[model samples]
Target: MIRTIDVHKSFNEQEVLKGVTTEFFPGKTNLIIGRSGAGKTVLLKILVGLVTPTTGDIFYGDVNFSQLNKKEMRAIRMKVGMLFQGSALFDSMSVEENIRFPLDMFTSMTWKEKAMQVDSCLERVSLGQVHKKYPSEISGGMQKRVGIARAIVLNPEYLFCDEPNSGLDPKTAIVIDELIRDITIDKNITTVINTHDMNSVMEIGDNIVLIHEGKLAWRGDKSQVLESTNDTLQQFIFASPFLQRLRAAALERSQEG
Candidate 1:
C-alpha cells in the first residue's frame, strides 16, 4: 500500500496541494480524480517522485518515501512502474525493444533472458504477436497495451497510470480499464491512476480520491459514488445535466431494490 500524511506542495507561493492525507490500498485501482486545476496531477507526481512535497510525508508500505535522498529514491524507483498519459512509446523502437527498455537499462541479463522477459510481458498484455511492429503501425489501443506491457516488464510492486484510457474509443477505453484492474489484482500491485474519466471510475475504481482546490475532498469506492452526499464530490462528478439525471435514476432504482 501507499499513503500520504498531511502532504503539501507549493511553487512560488502558489500552493498546489494542501495537507492531503490518504491511503491507497494494494491489489486495487486507487483513482485520483478531479476537474482540471484541482491538484490531482500534482499529487500523483508527488507520489511518483516527479515532484517534491513541501511538507508532510509519503510512504510506500513501511518506508518513508518523503525522506529518501536521490540514491535512496533511485533504489525505491526500481520497483515502480509508470504508464504515461501519451503511451510514451519510442517512435523508432519496435514493441519488443520498448518493453525491454527497462530490463536493458537496469539489468545485466543476457539478450536471451531479456527476450524471454519481453515475450512474457507481451503475452500478459495480450500483445505477443505485435512484438516486431512499431508504435505507428498499431492502433491507439494497441499502443496503450504496449505501454502497459512495458510498465509491467519489471514486475513492479507499484504501478502508476496517468489516464490509461485517453484517446481511445469508449469500448476500447473499457477494455483498457478492465485490463489494468486485472493486472493489478493478478500482481497485487499498489495501482494508482490519475484520471478524470468517470467511466473508468465506475468500472475499476476500487478506491477513489476526489481532490478539490488542493485538498482531498472525498475518498470512496465506485459503489459509494452515486449515493455519496459530499457536495464537492457531487458537483465534480455530476456536473453535466445528463449525468445528474442518470444519478437520480440510479438512486431511484436502488431505493426500489
Candidate 2:
C-alpha cells in the first residue's frame, strides 16, 4: 500500500496540492479523479517521486518514501512500473525488444532468460505473436496492450497509470480497464490509476479517490457512487443527462424498496 500524509506542493506562489492525505491499497485498482487543475495531476507526480511534496511524506508500505535519498529512491523505483497516457512505445523497437528494454537496462539476466521473461509478459497481456511488430504496425488498442506488457515486464511491486483510456473506443477502453484490474489482483500490486474514464470508474474502481481543489473531496468504491449525496462527487460523476437519468431511476427504486 501507498500512503500520503498531509502532502502539499507549491510552484512559485501558487499552491497545487494542499495538505492532502490518502492511502492507495494493494491488490485493487485505486483511481484518482478530478477536474483539470484540481491537483490530481500534481498528486500523481508526487506519488511517483517526479515532484517532491513541499510539506509532507509519501510512504510505500512502511517506508516513508519522501525522505529517501536519490540512491535509495532509485532502488525503490526499480520496483515501480508506469503506464503512460500515450502508450509511449518506441517506433524503432519491436514488441519483444520494447518489452525487454527494462530487463536489459536494470537486470543482468542472460539473453535467454530475458527473452523468456518478455514472452511471459506478452502472453500475460494476451498478445501472442506480433513479436516483430513495431508500434506503428499495430492498432492503437494493441499499442496500449504492448505498453501494459512492457510496464509489467519487470514485475513491479507498484504500478501507476496516467489517463490509461484516453484515446480508445468505449469497448476497447473497458478491455484495457479489465486487463489492468486483473493484473493488479493477480499480482496483489499497489496500483494507482489517474483516469477520466467513467466506465473505468464504474467497472474497476475498487478504491476511488476524488480530489477537489487540492484536497481529498471524497473516497469510496464504485457502489457508493450511485447512492452518494456528496454534491461535488455527484456533479462530477453524474454530469451527463444519461447518467443523471440512471441515478434518478436508481434513487426511485431505492425509495420503493
Candidate 3:
C-alpha cells in the first residue's frame, strides 16, 4: 500500500496541495479524482517521486519513501511502473523494443531472456500480434495497451496511471479500466490512478480519493460515493448532465422498487 501523511506542496508563493493525506491500498484500483488544477497530478508525482512534497511523509508499504537517499530512490523507482497520459509510446521503436526498454536499462538478462519477458508482457496486455508495429501503426487503444505492456514488463510492485482513459471512446475506455483493475488484483500491486473520468470511477474505483482545490475532499469506495452526504463531492460528480440523469433514474428506480 502507498500512504501519504499530511502532504503539502507549494510552487513559488502558491500552495498547490494543502496537507493532503490518503492511502492507496494494494490489489485495488485507487483513483484520485478532481477537476483540473485540483492538484491530483501533483500528488501522483509526489507518490512516484517525480516531485517531493514540501512537508509530509510518503510510505510504500512500511518503508518511508520521503527519507530515501538517491540510491534508495532509484531502487524504489525500479519497482514502479508508470502509464503516462498520452500512452507515451516511442514513435521510433517497435512494440517489442518498447517493452524491452526497461529490461535493457534495469536488468543484466541475456537478449533471449529479455525477448521472452517482452513477449510475456505483450501477451498479458493482449497485444502479442503487434510486436513489430510502431506506435503510429496502431490504434489509440492499442497504443495504450502497448504502454501498459511496457509499464508491467519489469513486474513492478506499484503502478501509476495518469489519465489512462484519456481520448478514448467509451467502450475502449471501459476496456482499459477493466484491464488495469484485473492486472492490479492479479499482481496485488499498489495501483494509483490520477483521472477525472467518472466512468472510470464507477467501473474500477475500489478506493477513491476526491481532491477539491488541493485538499482532500473525500475518500471512500464506489458504492459509498453513491450514498455520500458530502455536498461538494456530490456537486462535482453530478455536474455532468449524463451523471445527473443517471443518478435521477437510479433514484426513481430505487423508489419504485
Q: Kindly give the number of clashing pairs for every candidate.
A: 0, 0, 0
lDDT of 2 by residue, 2-112 (tens): 999999999999998989999999999999998888998799989999999999999999999999999999999999999988999988899889999999999999999
1-257 per-residue lDDT for model 1 (tens digits): 99899999999979989899999998999999999998998999999999999998999999999899999999999999999999999998999999999999999999999999998888888776898899999999999999999999889999999988889999999988999999999999999999989899888989999999999999999999988999999998899999999999989998999
Q: Is candidate 2 or candidate 3 better by lDDT?
A: 2
Quote the positional error of residue 235 for candidate 3 in Å.
1.3
Cα TM-score of candidate 1:
0.97
Query: What lDDT would candidate 1 get against the real structure?
Result: 0.93
- Candidate 2 residues lying further than 4 Å off, grouped into runs, are none
Please list all clashing residue pairs in model 3, or write none if there are none.
none
Q: How accurate locally is residue 71 in candidate 1, as Cα lDDT from 0 to 100?
A: 99
lDDT of each: 0.93, 0.93, 0.92
Model 3: residues with Cα > 4 Å off, grouped in runs: none
Backbone clash total, candidate 1: 0
- Model 1, stretches more than 4 Å misplaced? none
